[model samples]
Target: MKLISQPGPKTDFSMLLLFTIVVLTMPIWLAPIGAGYPDLVQKFAIYGLFATGFNILFGLTGYLSFGHAAFLGVGSYTAVWSFKLLGMNPVPAVLLAIVTSAIFALLIGYISLRRTGIYFSILTLAFAQMCYQLAYSVLTPITNGETGLRVLQSDPRILDGVITSQTEDGGPLITNFFGIDMTKTWETNIFGIDVQLNAGFYFCAFFLILGSYIAMRIFRSPFGMMLRGVKTNQNRMNYTGVNTRPYTLAAFVISGAYAGLAGALLCVTDPLAGAERMFWTASGEVVLMVILGGAGTLMGPMLGAGIIKYFENILSAFNKSTLEGMLGFLPENMLDGTISVLSLFVGEGWHLTLGLLFMVVVIFLPGGLVEGAKSILLKLTGGGSKKSASAQAAE
Candidate 1:
């Protein structure tokens, strides 16, 4: 038995520092791009965590599970239930959500791991769809069916015996850490830009940093190597007396725990749970995020999540009038034509733009955005490297 050493300290520190800086400064940098709003930023952190988790299983083990949304939904439901029965504090809610979702993932992974390839994918998708239907119909009592489950003042909240569940005018209770409200936002002007420092966004960002660090550790560990072996050739490993199922299952559970944490953050920012979170499309979207960014790479999933969410929230808000305003400098006839053609790629047609982008990435940069950036960098430095090598050889 041999020990697996940690990732090189310099590499881990630099990567973690860069990631932390990028995430923490998002509000300042993203303001010009119209994505600095608290709500949107919160979503970026949450989904980034989700995609990073999914990358663990799909990227390392080569086992794609489409039913991760079931774990997500379970986490959400568990968090809301915790708030309803326990207190308005997010700590208990988040802890319970991760535990419950991990257990759910364990059960699902145990069964799905029996097969491989597309059969495994289909099985996971089937399980997710079944969970969706159950939440939407049969499990209505717990999930609140189509209406969704939400925290209410009438709920027991035993942990907060004397704390008021309503505002001065009687509004619903809000989730908080200690006395700090999760929905609280401090608005300030920085360098002539409107910057919002949100409590909830920072909270989610904290978890995102933690999740990324843990994921990095896993990627550098011996267990991660075993999972990679499973991806490379499970049959060969099996023949060599290596039992790969346990490694694959562990990765699945860890990934599910990450999804659960993201789901809990969702409810922490907004105390509600819905069946829609468990939909097949939700699972599919995370898959797209991982693929669009770069599977098997740490920061790729987060980048993909940010791009997709930016399109969904900012680009999708563009209307005919909005387009006309931006293109007002053009001639009357030209402006109208431009708006007409561009209309299909913005606002309601944002998905069309996403599809085209996905197609281009798949065709040109099969390794996603990370690979594209790397290729560009190589081109920029390739000539200088060649010249230096020739000079050294002549000497």
Candidate 2:
């Protein structure tokens, strides 16, 4: 393994400017894509955080964890409990979730780091599975069993002066920061394009930007250099008197905290945390996102996350009628056959599409969509460097 790839010297503020532009204009771009709704938009930010954080460990240090979702679930449960017992304000909930998940990651990572390669992966998977089972059964009092944990009407929010489960609109109590309601949205129809922008999404986007900045700083730091050293050759680092375990453990904890933060954000957006969030498949999904987007690259995970969320929310909603409208130019029998074939990839069968895409990425674009795009651009310009291509491929 080549560890994290340094693509080249970056121009000052170029990345920052790009990230800012993308974050600021998502509502406009997503509107045309039929995913301008608040919930799906928030998901893009939350999962972007999760995948970016996972990349810090897996991409930089080559540690493939199959138990990161355990931290995400822990974060969710902690946030909900904070709301139920402390207050509806999300600041304390987010802080508590990060600290709690960090401690959990420290313990789990310490033990799991005793092994490397496949053994390490299995250890993380086992820990996550144990957490899932515990939450589902033994920890029912804490996790609320399979029904999951949610803010209840009768709970006391000690920090806030007034605590009511029902708002004036008679809807369920929503999360807020101070007096700014997280669920409040401004809906607009411009030229027949419906757009819904919510405060919750902006909140999540702020954190996502913060998280991306932190990840970028880490990637450029000397500490990040040490991590790549550990990934490339741990035994050689050990021989050179460098302690690799601490570095790996710290990365694991940081990644876990990131996962926890993502979970808390999920709760902040919807205020529901289910035991199912801790499943191994949830962890696998993050892994897929990292690999599919070009792991080790800053924007790759975010791109991968956006692709998955778009498919999950938008593509999966396409029914036969929607397909017919898109394929209206076809004859009746031909349209029906096309819809039947396409239906296997859209709607409830979106997972099949996801799987096929995953296979294509693995086979043809091993460095993922970003690297493939880079290769294409390099070819078009007739200035391709083999060394740069290899570095991009390694990522």
**Can you give the lDDT of residue 103 in candidate 2?**
94
Worst 10 residues of 1 by lDDT: 161-170
lDDT of 2 by residue, 31-93 (tens): 887777888889999999999999999988998999999999999999999989987888899
Give the runs in model 1 whose Cα sits over 4 Å from its true position. 1-7, 161-169, 383-395
TM-score of 1: 0.93
TM-score of 2: 0.92
TM of each candidate vs. truth: 0.93, 0.92
Residue pairs in steric clash, candidate 1? none
Kindly give the number of clashing pairs for every candidate: 0, 0
lDDT of 1 by residue, 1-395 (tens): 12224559797899899989999989999999899999999999999999999999998999988889988999899999999998888889999999999999999999999999999999999999999999999999899999999988788888764453434346768887877899999999999999999999999999999999999988888788888899999999899888998889999999999999899999997999999999999999999999999888888999999999999999999999998888989998788788999999999999999999999988898888996786667559765465456658778
**Which parts of model 2 are misplaced by more than 4 Å?**
1-12, 162-171, 189-192, 331-333, 385-395
